[model samples]
Target: MKIGIEGQRLFRKNKHGMDFVTLELIHGLQQIDRRNEYVIFIQPDSDICIEEIANFKIQAFSSLAYPAWEQWALPRIAAKERVDILHCTSNTAPIWSSIPQILTLHDVIFLEKPQTTGSSKNWYQRFGNQYRKAIVPTVAQRCQMIITVSNYEREQILKTLPLPQGKLKVVYNGVSRRFKQIQNKRELINIKEKYRLPKKFILFLGNTDLKKNLKGVLLAYSIFVENSETVIQLVIVDLKQKYLSEVLKELNLPGLQEHIVLPGYIPNRDLPAVYNLSDLFLYPSLRESFGLPVLEAMACGVPVIASNTSSMPEVAGDAALLVDPKDALLLANDIGAMLSHNNLRQRMIRKGFRQAERFSWQNTAEQVLQIYENTSKSRVTRMAA
Candidate 1:
């Protein structure tokens, strides 16, 4: 079958969760399926990471805006290429397309009520959420199949939208091979020097999003620091210093910045070293479809402390210590406990390794390929009828 995969943000320099998922999917498919012809659709940008293989093609289409690119240009191009099935890896897809489309709706957090005040402060994020709100329901109704990341998110989607019984599929995300525990002393030292990381630190991959529970983390960390005998640093990635300063001001803990390290954006390739050098990893998000970072840290042999709500419990299993994200004191206490007890920390680390092994990108790709073939066959049968 001729397959078209929408990977519009694959070429961007700073890729987020969905972008990485799409990139891994393409890599997985390339490794396994050489017989089926594949076409990848992306918007032209920097960081040209993907290369064309024997049976795969990379097509770049430039547009002034994201909505214009997806809604107007994408379908027209896919139809012109005569693609048998077009898979939109992101949440939104072109609604008017006739080419049997499969949408990977990672989560429906946009449709639910906003959890925290000022969560959507970033203009781009706010616009994207609004666009998904307007686009996803219609696309979900028209698409051939809908793929979500976790069972908790699947139920969330069903509670909000009325999808058919068999339309939604749950395929878990995988930890990249690069995230495994690194033992090279020199390599670890290099990453530490590059990021100006302290000897002992707790890693929190935080940003400006309110759902990330940044406020809660800061409150918890402050409590942890005040109570602990040893001084430890907090390493936060992809967070701007200016916004963090503002948050510190609001929280009335201006002095807390001294213990916090803002290393900005670290490339995916360099993350494993950072994870390995850290004492603990924090994933205290208010909600998540699939908490990918939790597994990434676990794969690096770092113990984790994550929120108890949403799909976190399911994804984290019994590997990481789970606590209420809203209660700052509870999260703080767990952080101290995880750091203090050697036996408990080592036991959790072993369980984390086992949990992280449960998911793989190859398995995800195989399931997606099956869906494509089934979709193609069903389309042909309908045309014959």
Candidate 2:
């Protein structure tokens, strides 16, 4: 079978969760089915960057508009390639296509939490009822198969949309092996100096966007530090400047300013060391399909404290402490408990390692490949019948 994958996110230098997802899927595909042909569909400019990316053919297109490419150009390209199946790591597999299609919907965050991003907010603000009336039903009726990152998200998909249960698949994500425990003492020292690391710091790794629950994290940190000032520090990375400024102003904090570190956008290569050097990982996001950072932290032997809602508890398992994201006081108390109680911290660390081992990109890929084979055979059987 000929498999085509969406590879646009490769254009980004600092790839996020989706980019990693696409890359790992390809890696697994090549290992599982070397004899079967693979075609990676990339953006035109990204072609040069991904020339060495895979041992497969690449179909490239150049376009700045995301929705336009998916709506208009993608199906034409898929048909031209005579692809047997097209798996979209991103959402929406061209409104129409001759080839069988599989869509990887990261989350229906746009559907569930419309205010989370600018476009969704605009769509809802301008045409709230009409947009939902038009798009939601269209997707439920037309799409062949649905893929989500976690059981939590799969449940959401099933609940919100009227679709057959068989079409939905839950394939968990894997943390890159590169994000393992830090070993190099000199590298750790250099990273500490570079990012101005604190002696004992609890770390949060997400953008400054409000939905990531940055404000809540800051309030919790403030409360935690006020009660026990000298125990550990708080590091906030990848926050937008505007949000950072607002958070600082609201804090109106004094010497606590020194304790709060905002080191912007750490390189992916350095994440392992960053996780290793920190005391704890805190992810207070109000939304997530699967919290990849939580898994990455566990791999690095870092104990985590995450929100109890959405997909977090599912991702965290029993490894890390889970707290209500809305309650700043409860969040603060969880951080305090992790920091002060030596026995609790030790137990979480051991549990985290075991939890991290449960997921693997290789396993996910193998499962997907089996689906492709089954899908192809079913098509053949239908023709025969």
Candidate 3:
């Protein structure tokens, strides 16, 4: 099979859940499907991060056009490459491309709730919304097959568009095995020294989107500081310091200084150590499709306390301490409980590893291959008839 996998997501830095889903899935695809002729379509200046994967080929398109290029230029190149299929790892796909596509929809947060309406609104315009409006539903309807990270997201797609039940496929996101099996002690010390991290700290990673419920995290952290005897610091990684400071003021945290730490975007390679060194992982997101860090924390054997909404309950399973994102008290209490109880923390680690085991890129890719073959055969049978 000649496949062209989109390489844009790997270039996205300081990205949260969906980006990781895309990057890791590409790695997994290469690992499992080496027999297939694969060509990764990257924008210029990608630098080819993963040198170890020798099975496939890497080619570049114009980085300047970037986002719009996927729809504009990549499709023509994909046809030239004679790609039997185009797996759009990112949600965006070419509207006019006749090539069969395997488009991955990580979540439908924007379509379900236009986040830019209320006080939660971040900016006047978000990237790719305009492109995605035409790209997503069109691909969901027009593509040979659709891939969603969660069953919850699949159901949401059904609600959003009238794609048939058989058209969609569910492939859970994978946790890097390194996260589950790592000796980050030296690295953790290095991270602490490098970042000047606190001794006892709560951790939150990823973008501070409206659904991420960072406001709830800040409020709960404030309550934790107020009620707990010990001073537990809260460290948020991968958001703009300016944005975080504004969030602090927004949540009235400037007055409560020294409780919060806003260190901007850490490299993905460095996150395992960060997860290992932390006291607990608090994810108070309003909703998440897969909840990547929750799995990352579990893989690092760190106990997790996450919001009980969206696919989180399904993703976290029994591995995490679920809390109501809106309830500051519940969030704070759960955070404290995870910190205080060693046995409970250990139990979470075991459960988390088990949950993390249930997903792997290899398994996900194999399932996708099956879907491709099934979809391809279906199209052929219909065409012949």
- lDDT top scorer: 1
Better of 2 and 3 by lDDT: 2
Which one wins by lDDT: 1 or 3? 1
Full ranking by lDDT? 1, 2, 3
Candidate 2 displacement at residue 64 in angstroms:
3.6
Model 1 lDDT at residue 291: 95
Which 10 consecutive residues of model 2 have the lowest summed lDDT? 117-126
Clash count for candidate 2 is 2
Q: Residue 346 CA error for candidate 2 (Å)?
A: 1.1
Give candidate 1's total backbone clashes: 0
What candidate 3 gets wrong by more than 4 Å, as runs, is 12-15, 52-55, 115-125, 382-385
Q: Considering summed lDDT, which 10 consecutive residues are worst modelled in model 1?
A: 112-121
Per-residue alpha-carbon lDDT of candidate 2 for residues 1-385, written as tens digits (9 for 90 to 100): 7888888767666666677788878877766677677888877652244443344787878666765677678778888988888887765556667777778877766565456532322243346334444454465456667778999998888877778999888888886677777778999999989988887788998564446777688788888888985758778877555666656687775455667778888867777889999999998788888999999999999989988898998989999999888799999999889888999999999999999999888888888888788778877887899
Cα-based lDDT for every prediction:
0.93, 0.78, 0.76
lDDT (C-alpha) at residue 331 in model 3 = 91
In candidate 1, what are the lDDT values of residues 1-385, reduced to their tens digit? 8999999999999999999999999999999999999999999999898899999999999999999999999999999989999999999999899799999999988898875424567999999999999999999999989999999999999999999869999988887888898879999999999989999999999988788989999999999999989868999999999999999999999999999999999988899999999999999999889999999999999999999999999999999999999999999999999999999999999999999999889999899898888888989999999
Q: For candidate 3, give the lDDT of residue 244.
A: 75
Query: Whole-model lDDT, candidate 3?
Result: 0.76
Error of 1 at 93 (Å): 0.2
